[model samples]
Target: MRRSVRSPYTIDLGQLHFSLQYNNWPIGYVESTNDNITIHSGENAIQFFGELQSISSESYNALSTVIQNFLTGQTSKIEVLAGPNATSYPLLAAGIVGLSLNVHMPPFSEQLIASLIFKSMSLIPSTNTRNVMLSASITIKINSPLGQQSPLNIQMMNMSVFLLYENDSVGMLSVYQAPVKQL
Candidate 1:
């Protein structure tokens, strides 16, 4: 008679500790099928946006907040105030518009996404991680080729973002830059 036997080797921590999170924005960007569009090939995007006028639009603030929170896995305690116009707050302002962090969680990996920059400077974060996702709303302050009159407004409002981060034991800065790949 042959009997089935069991050989067991198990990791016994009894009480395991881990965090589970699933988050995303419903009213987010819808991707355009066109891949021929060029993105951020200009001189300096960060600086470029700075020169442009800013709006008191909560859209930009919300977008920035989501990005910072998602990347850092933390909540922002301050209440961000919106202005009457887009140019009210400088592109770069005195206060920290979004939350920042320094994380050092192990098992680090990065995912790169291709996205386009809109005239209004909002970015639609790509969908990747199971927990966190971001959506952007753009408001153009200037009347130009990329404004509402121009159909390019929608196309310009696209962006790609890195979407995974584990809280480091000794959190200093939340891992933000996933790095842009070079051709």
Candidate 2:
């Protein structure tokens, strides 16, 4: 299924430019398509933005929702496959590149959750540390007949910001702020 996520005021670490448009991600199918023939694509997509420290998928909707949502949306597309007498739909992804990085994620402690906000940043220069204002968050919905919803805790004990860097792109080592509040 197709899911939607909205990101407001995304930062461009390269040119230090702020994208004028708010980020919208239709990630999971919210109300329709209860099956799993899925596909999705995006530009400047924020699904997994930085070096993935930790990742997991609780539950997901069907494949058709992914295809239809992507086909009808601007950030994504759906492809139709035709054979002798059959038709198939799939989500299009140009290519896949894996990233590897070494990061220190300190365990969360009472001292850590003591506050309501935590901050984090990618490897950046000392000069740029003061300039790192980028942030990311997620909103999740639980699938059930009652239609319950809640934001899942994707953050670890350590409040680390997930930042993406292009191949050959490099930033300096700096301190980041990522605040977290216990629910």
lDDT of 1 at 178: 29
Minimum summed lDDT over a 10-residue window in model 1 is located at 44-53
- How does candidate 1 score on lDDT? 0.28
Provide TM-scores for the models: 0.16, 0.17
Per TM-score, the best of the predicted structures is 2
The C-alpha lDDT values of all candidates are 0.28, 0.27
Model 2 has an lDDT value of 0.27
Give the total clashing residue pairs for model 2. 32
TM-score of decoy 2: 0.17
